[model samples]
Target: MAQLSDDCFAFGGDLMPVHAALDLLRSRVAPVTAAETVPLADALGRVLAEDVVAPFDVPPHDNSAVDGYAVFFDDLQADGETVLPVTGRVAAGHLLGREGRRGEAVRIFTGAPMPAGFDTVLMQEDCRPIKDANDGDSVAIPAGIKRGANRRKAGEDVTRGSVVLATGRRLRPEDVGLAASLGRKELSVRRPLRAAVFSTGDEVREPGQELPQGCIYDANRFALIAALRQLGCAVTDLGILPDRLEAITEALERAAAEHDVLITSGGMSTGEEDHVKAAVEALGALHFWRLAIKPGRPVALGQVRDAVFVGLPGNPVAVMVTFLRIARPILLRLMGAEESEPRLFPVKAAFAYKKKAGRREYVRARLARGEDGALTAVKHPRDGAGVLSSLVESDGLVELPEDLSRLEPGMTVEFLPLSEVR
Candidate 1:
């Protein structure tokens, strides 16, 4: 059984800055368990736990890049076309037995290993064959051809003993192909982080249930679970917990005991029915931080035993925002993943908006390129946190800086791509 301390629950002073809180959270987390094995086909998206070094050159030998004649460049007639005797034919996977003799050319096809003493290849389309004393025995080579042209040299792509992939690289399809090219049958990768997800609040009902006058179905849990899966986490859906201290506490205890991290939405704010904070405090520690961000002002971060706890807002948009802004970094750290800064691009604002300083705001916006070829962002009609339909119609989020009070049309603002958010 795991245990938690209440040391973080004593929030007696002003809330800490988001960056500062994140630093503290990251410093306290330990790396997850890791293992290594051969998973050539199923290794995509797994984080590399060790560096991969190449044992051999990518191209084992110099090979022909085209179907042509292999020749010694020095023997070519510089003034005009030079005719040479065709020594032998070399195709892919078959090499000429002996080195090329002076004034003799080897007839080679694409991917044929370059014979010794041969330095250049003339494409079959670039040369005209001439008849010799013995038909099919000799051919004429063209002049003005450079040395080493159309020849793929060995060790060009990857050299032996070179570091092909560093630790913490997430293996993608291309990475897997590269590893296969290097003859790697196995890879060492960090274990996927196990996350237990649940939702709270008496007013929240599971989908397919009849909704009461003031109740709504739980959507955050499913959304978060899908997002977690996309992030390569092994997620366990713990379902919904009522707004009762005992029930919430029991769920937290069970989750902490079985999972690497526990995540819950709603019931962390100051409402009378909010029991998530109390349950976290009773289990271990709870740190409720007022994020200087619109829509998602209340966010919680703490730990229960060895399992990390993240509390997201009940509002749909707030849940999405807080998870991307805060939870993503911590989860990646726990998984021993490399840190990649979110890609932000500049887009011209198409509408004017008013906001206060000292609070970050992410507005759902649709992007379009104007007739003049300038990219522009237009705000969604509804800015409410519950308008999830807006997100479905938007391309990405327009980031309003913490110091900006108003945004005017044609002003350049940073845009966070939705691809990066999930």
Candidate 2:
């Protein structure tokens, strides 16, 4: 089993800053070293454990880009229209047996390897057919048809011996298609990380269950499970655990022994009912972090046996926000991905708001084309961490860094799409 560094992460001084805590967490994790070969069908979202090197040049040889006539550029009449005798036909998988003569052209289709001695192709639309006595059929080509036009050169897309996909990359659809284009039947990827997700509040009931007075539906667990599935983890849904300390403790211990990671929500707060932190501390080492961030002001990271524990808060919005801000990167690292940080794009803010210094905040916002034609982030009206509707209504989070306390309209800020995390 992969393990984090023996020395615990640093958090003794003041409350850990967001970036500092993230760095410490990632630095301590050692990506899983195990690897297995899987067919391309099952490779999506799997981290590559080996660099995919192209054994041969893509296209294998120069080929036609369209159905047209292939000719030597030098053979074309530069001053005016040039007529050439049609020699033979070539389709995607078919090639002419012999090289073309200077005064002749090969009728070629898309993806057909360029016949020897031919370096240019003219689309069928650009050439007119002409009758010929000796050659039987010929083509009238216009002048100024540049050399190498309408042809895909061998190795243009991918060169031989080049590393096409590097190790630690999570395979996307395009990446899988690329491997197929290079004739790769299978890929070496890291084993999928196993995770268990559950809730621990007696007040949190399933959606279909008859709602008792003062009881709410458990929404965070389902969302967390979905996100884990999207990240390619084999998730074991533990459902809602009983609120008893002994029950939660036993569940945590069992999950720790079985899964690589244990993710639980609603028990990291300071309330007396919170039992996740206590259970984790009793079973293993737990580090509670007061990260300088809004929505998610507190988070807990710990290890139980060989499994990592990510304790998330209860508020629906806070759960999603904290998961994206902290748990996402740590889980990615545990999955053997070297680059776990989500992509953030810069856009202008459309609203004004005052913020406190020394805390990073994620404002729910949607992008719109302003009257000036520039992309701007329109803030959702509500900023409450409990308002899960804001997360659903907005496209992403507009991250306000920890330095500036004031944000005026048109100020540029980093926007992280919800898609980035899942």
Candidate 3:
């Protein structure tokens, strides 16, 4: 369970900006503080509970970067071609027998440690070997090559006792590989947050079931389950709940007792069929009623016992938009993940759009490369929140800030790709 600061919701007004609401949401919830050890094979997508310190230097020794000939810089001829006897061979994982005298070269392969007293390397391509046996295998190299040009220094990537990873970092593929490089067989990470997801509506039915008159198939719950799973949550699909306060409240109470969060769709509004808001109010507390955002204005946030609750609109596009913009960050914080804003890339807009100045809006847009070969975001043909096909047809969302009211073609705007938030 987590606690919030008392003044987290002090907006001093009815509606708040998107950033303001996000900051308030973040200020209230605390990250899960429990940890469990898991093997590195199962560490991907999990948040680290503690900082990981490197045990030793990455390479452990100075090594050659390429297959070349190792030589002492001082042994080279000052003004002319220098010839040296190929005294011994040093292969990777194998060492040379002894140090060579003046005017001598040692054949070295990639990843082989720099031999004693050797300070320079010459690629085999630049050296010509003499065929005469009297010289006992010799190479002639030109003078004036720089010292230490083809060597990789030890501790270049990671030094001993350095912090390799910070706490609350969501482990990516490269991060996992780094732990492996530090000789870590297991990582301590926060346990996945348990989420109970469902929907409430008499007009909604499962996709495989026969649709009744004036009813549509439920898509939000399925999509929500997938998104939660992507965020490394243990998701339990609770199916659809009937449009009754008792049924929704009972289900939410039971879920709150066993899970870390309860997520429901389509019942936060004031319609006669809406019961999720009432159910949460009866069992726990409702912290927020709506966000000042178009397409998904009726989003709700609350808590039931120790479990947090999120209520989303019924429109498919709005559901996706609100979840990405609002619920995703909150869920991540609850799972002990470090806060990270979704990445936004600046691109030119190819379509014109007009939106209200008071509400934050996200337009479904497809990206196209112009004749100048720059990516330009084009708004989808339809802007209806219920149009689920727009999400599939478009590449991502073009975010319009609250202060701006007009968008002209070729104007620079921030484009957020769909894959980034996921």
- Which one is best on TM-score? 2
Candidate 2: stretches off by over 4 Å: 1-14, 133-135
Off by over 4 Å in 1: 1-17, 77-79, 131-133, 137-145
Across 1-422, the per-residue lDDT of candidate 2 in tens digits comes to 95555422222345667888798887676775479999998899999999999999997999999999999999988889998889799999887988878888989999999888899999999999988676499999999888889989999899999999999999999999999999999999999898999998989999899999999999999989988998999899999997778999999899988898999888876668888888888899875555777777658788877889898888889899989889989899999996899999999999998876877888999989989998899999998878999999999999999898999998899999887777
lDDT of 1: 0.84
List the candidate 3 regions with Cα displacement exceeding 4 Å. Answer: 1-13, 77-81, 97-102
Clashing pairs in 2: none
Candidate 1 or 3, higher TM-score?
A: 3
Each candidate: how many clashes?
1, 0, 0
lDDT of each: 0.84, 0.88, 0.88
lDDT of 1 by residue, 180-213 (tens): 9988888889888899999988888999999999
Clash list (residue pairs), candidate 3: none
At residue 284, give the lDDT of candidate 1: 87
**lDDT (Cα, tens digit) per residue for candidate 3, span 1-422:** 65554532233356656787788779877775479999999999999999999889988877788888889888888788988888888998987867656678888999998777787889888888876757578889887778886877889889999999999999999999999999999999999999999998898999999988999999999999999999999999999999999999999999999998889889987778899999999988987877778778778888998889989988999999999999998888998888657898999999888877887899999999987999999899998888999999999999999889999999999999998987
How displaced is residue 404 in candidate 1, in Å?
1.9
lDDT-better candidate, 1 vs 2: 2
